[model samples]
Target: MAFFCQTDSYATELLTEVVSCSPAQLKTENGGKKETLSGYNVILKDTVLFPEGGGQPDDRGLIGEVPVHRVTRQGPEAVHFVSSLLDPGSEVLVKVDWNRRFDHMQQHSGQHLITAIADSLYGYKTTSWELGRQRSFIELDTPTMTTEQAEAIEQLVNQKIRQRVPVIVRVITTDDPEFNQVRSRGLPDDHAGPVRIIDIEGVDANMCCGTHVANLSDLQVIKILGTEKGKKNKTNLIFLAGERVLKYAARSYSVEKSLTALLKNGPEEHIEAVEKLQKSVKTLQKNNLTLLRDLAVLTAQSFKNSPDRSKIFSLHRKEGDNEFMNIIANEIGTEDTIVFLTVGDEKTSGLFLLAGPPEIIDQVGPRAAKILDGKGAGKKGRFQGKANKMSQRGEVESLLQGVLNGTAPKEE
Candidate 1:
């Protein structure tokens, strides 16, 4: 039989210690070996500096004026990574950038409030959290929720922010009876110490390892940017909080002003102006279609007296507006005729080729596709491809003749 003794698992430290130490810079030589510095991991001893876990990024700061380049978790310990290598066994004073830590705490706490609101409002549980460079998103267990529900949850989160309830952190043994009432994803099986539970008064209680603000008011505002659906019944709820909210608001205001200027209307009237423009575009499209029909008729008349004895007609339509080419192709046909039309619009060009009769189509269709560098196959020997480049009408006509004479093979 063996007996094991228990001891305090958490470390305690004072902020004054971090401030008293002088900052140092390291010079590396000979491929990352022989390091000499008096730097030690700060929160490693006190369990304060955030460790990488739970989809949340670790806290960033300087220790004794040496900026922490990274924070990684090894087994159950958080290894603070500094740019300069440190002596393995040396004990050095450490410091954390209190502002950065506090800001992150506010953001993380705000996320809890918003996610909890989502769960309360729509039975959505946060299955994951991603802290990104400029923003963060909480992934919900349920992928879908009505827009009304999302708006309502956003409103409720803001209301809670206004209420400003106290945030309490309690350390408890895994065997605590009250732990059962706190709905959470449960602790990691590998966690060896006591669990730290963060409770937002009567709002929410969950197991978390990240730092947090003491009061909800410290979070300022939490703005839900939008929601996006993900795989496997999950959705990402994007949001920003505290100082980020102000930055977002300012940027949005600037964008709105720019849009108003471009649209020639105030922000309130922007939607109406856009609708008007859309209606105008729709009307113009109808008129353009009518014009294309008339132009196709004129194009057909020109070909009626074509001088070419081979029945190969090459015509170019205005850049873009493929409707005319399609209309022309469908209207005219000969026993062994191939029609080539090129249309160009400002940005893109189109090509249309129509061949008639099985023998004629087989000879000309593949040749047209080859010459145009496009692809199409049809039972009636019709083919179409966007012109690979503009000004290929002559080449297309020449290829049609070559294929008809059995001199050209089908393009690969």
Candidate 2:
């Protein structure tokens, strides 16, 4: 059935009677699972709420004190989902959420203006458009759009808005000759009856059923955010209209102020200051790495001269890495020596490294990793892996010692 909002877009509240009310169930998918929701489906004799259709969201509001959570069109009826059932043939007061309705109207009308201008000036036909909560986008048939072309279209659209052009809505039969002139995505297969056309003064005339403002000036402003490459060689033009544009501008200003204070520079100097700081940090990191390598060499030299150095060596460093442990093992220079190293702090999982003769590594490497509940692979004589059970470092050391003493099981 035809809705009152199709013609009287400014109405917010209606005194109507309920034609039918029945218990209803809606099925929806959540996290890859299907679920059913129980509610009452109410049909009103007249309503101001716009049902979900034409890429626009449904209008939400209260119906005689009970909240209407969702409104959708099924066949010829506008189905309102309510928590409780309303009495059939009972008189009711239906109110639409004006803020949400106006926002949708602004975005929908702005999209029509943009789509019309793009086609008239550049021959880029609009394939689709989406009216989002914070922003909207129109997909063009072209593969790409240059910055200059987008700016020019934005300028032209704003100029039309400044003209305060009248936005006229008219219902015409499908047989009317002017119907062919109206730019439309095309009527639905099941659509019948009189077609509604929106005429923007001398600018555009298009077939649309969505609510729109009475004048172009009601859009306040239209700001083109940018464009992105869409599926199948199409360009999606991102834009914000009316109140959304103001909200975006305010958010950008807040971020700029925060950056200016944190960087100790003006807005224009932020990039240069950040680049210089990054270069300085890189230089310091390089120096720190050189010191770590030198420390590893000195530590290995001290261990090399130890009189108690055995065929199998077991050591644990409070805060060392696999690279440091490997360097130390390589410096030992004894072909028969084996090194079992665990390095980390009390707060972290730490790492384990086993470097030694090929025969010993092949036999005990996988066993050592199993004790630590980790995994590793060995090549030549080195094996390394992360040990998530840091407190079990002592257990790993003891297992390696058993292999050295020939007490551990041999790999058969």
Candidate 3:
């Protein structure tokens, strides 16, 4: 059955009766997974809302006061998914989201025009197309596109829009004589109604089921933003049409304004300013690393000079890394005194290193790994890795003390 939106793309509201509302079992997501659902599948007697079909998203609107989030076609009927149940045979007002509907119409029609022109003018058949949230892409049966070819195509596509070419819709049985002449991309396996032929007068005739603008003028404009390499044997042409192009311009200008204010420069100098800022950041990072090394050496020297230093030493630093821990371990000379060092948030996770006698290193490494909820490996009296529970540093200290007192137990 031809949906009301497909026949009358401009209609935004319709009065309809509910045919059936059944409890939903599951909904299909990406990867063919069916998740448990919490909604009812409603079938309207007639609907103005469009179901997701032919590379177009389903229309969003309302069935009475309840919002209809999604609509899909099961065979010939448009199944509307709604949260609240509506009684069968009861009348309800169906409303279509006009902005979304018209946007889809503009992009779908614009894609048809581009596909038709590209195939006829350049012999690049459109293998597929996408209706993206920001920009749409048309995948053509070619390896690459040049700047000159892109400019020429954009110019010609807009010329037709300027000429206000009429977009006519014809619904006919599949066996009609005219059906054989139109550019058909094939119909759905469950298609039950007449085939639709969207005719752009004097330009092209394409078999499409999605909603479309009444004329090329309704598209407002078509901007070929750029092209990208698609699959091994194809190229994708990226473009935005109608309100999307306007939205793109608005967002670009807003970003430009913010950048100009932050960089203290005009749009022309923003790129150069950003480059200079990045260079300065690199210099500061180099200077900071040098300071951290100096601080690590001084910290180790302070521990070595203390007269009352214990054989087992523990230290924690908030803003140090693995390199800093290794430097302190080397400076303090951990052959005789066992050292426990950590760098990160005291209450969270960070890097840990234990460097001391080989016997204790072997015994305590596995125990530390379990306590810290992390993993590590070492040889020649050095064990280090990430520790998720740096907050459990006390438990690690107790285990190391057990090694010092010769009371550490052997695991079976």
Candidate 4:
């Protein structure tokens, strides 16, 4: 069995013959405008565009102008899968996006440093990971950690970054006891081939298929962006690596600057400014209630002064909320009088009616309902109903006057 290092693994071998490509090549993809590439399965070449059984994304570029859609390892063979048809023995140029490759390297390397720090300092291990397009996250075995503990790990990662320790990738056979002795996020039992171990001297070691930086310094930074509660005893952590950290910082600063202008406050006063605004809103709500109460009293007095007084009377008004109707009815309600009020906007209406003895609410209540296009049942003289529209107020007032004077029939 042979063991390959990280540096040598990237180089492609000369292909004397072509074996296969995926159906994707024929369709044209990977930013290519072409139609397809030949060979479906076995690109029997020592050089490979396929990213093997690693969890990392496949390498994408061109295999002689044909897009290499994907790369997967089958058993012991390396396959060069392409997206467009290609002729056998065709001599073609291969291009790989080194920038993308290096970005993956930085992220993978950062994961190792952080994982090692967590395991060494707190006995927590990374259980799983999701490498997304815009962001990436790792799940840890423990559900939660104190901010102090996480900060310590973060500090350790920075220390390692500054130290610039070398990162080594080597393959060891299952038969090797040294491989079993390593404490890592262990590999799957089904992975029977040579076990690839990533070792950072005096820092951390793990089994991984993803690419990584040659040294810790290449990572630049490993920032844990945030954490969220995961399964029973795990927590998920979001992180940024290398150039992403720089990008995140730039974007965050821009947001802060814009917020400062909108809020009319400096960073130190932002929180205070927001809190003050909330307090002002509450004060305005309280003051509004006081004003409504005063207005309702004045309106009720005007109704009492009118010569068209009836045994049952109601006033329809529009105001902020249902509170206004209740206030008006209660202010005019006396032992022998019933005053009903309905208040609302075009959207909806609310009713409040009060009765006092000589309180013939029962006799007049139903009449009020009929006039308002609403229904309510009560004895004596008190009744209330929601009118369909504001225009119904006049009809409602006229019906109450007729019922009180005995000039109109009450039952219907």
- By descending TM-score, how would the candidates be arranged? 3, 2, 1, 4
Q: Score each candidate by Cα lDDT.
A: 0.67, 0.86, 0.91, 0.67
Per-residue CA lDDT of candidate 3, range 1-412, in tens? 7888888999999999999999985465756775766899999988999999888888999998899878988898999998898999999999999999899999999999999889878899998899997899999999988989898889999999999999999888888999888997788887886898899999999898899999999999999999999997899999999999999999999999999999999999999999999999999988888899999999899999999999987999998899999999999998898989999989889989999999879878878978898899998888999989988999899888887887766566
Return the lDDT, model 3, position 140: 93
| lDDT tens digits, residue span 1-412, model 4 | 1212143544443234454433433344565565565555536444434364344666665666566656655554555665456666656566566666666667777777887888899998888777666677778899697778878888889888999898888778879887777765566455566777788988776767666777889889888877888887798877888988998899989988997999988988988988998899999989988998889888777777879866665555565455676566666775556566766763355554535453456665655566556666544434445555555666656655665577765464
Error of 1 at 346 (Å): 9.4
Best-performing candidate as measured by lDDT:
3
- What lDDT does candidate 3 reach at residue 183? 90
Better of 2 and 4 by lDDT: 2
Q: Which of candidates 1 and 4 reaches a greater lDDT?
A: 1
lDDT of 1 by residue, 64-165 (tens): 556775565656656665655444444554445566666677678888898788888778888878777578888888867667877788788888878989
C-alpha TM-score for every candidate: 0.66, 0.74, 0.87, 0.60
- Residue 204 shift from truth in candidate 2, angstroms: 1.4
Pairs with backbone N, CA or C atoms under 3 Å apart (clashes), candidate 2: none
Number of clashing residue pairs, candidate 1 = 6
| Clash pairs, model 3 backbone | none
Candidate 3 C-alpha error for residue 349, in Å? 4.4
lDDT of 2 by residue, 67-89 (tens): 98889877667889998889998
What's model 2's TM-score?
0.74
How many residue pairs clash in all the candidates, one count each?
Answer: 6, 0, 0, 28
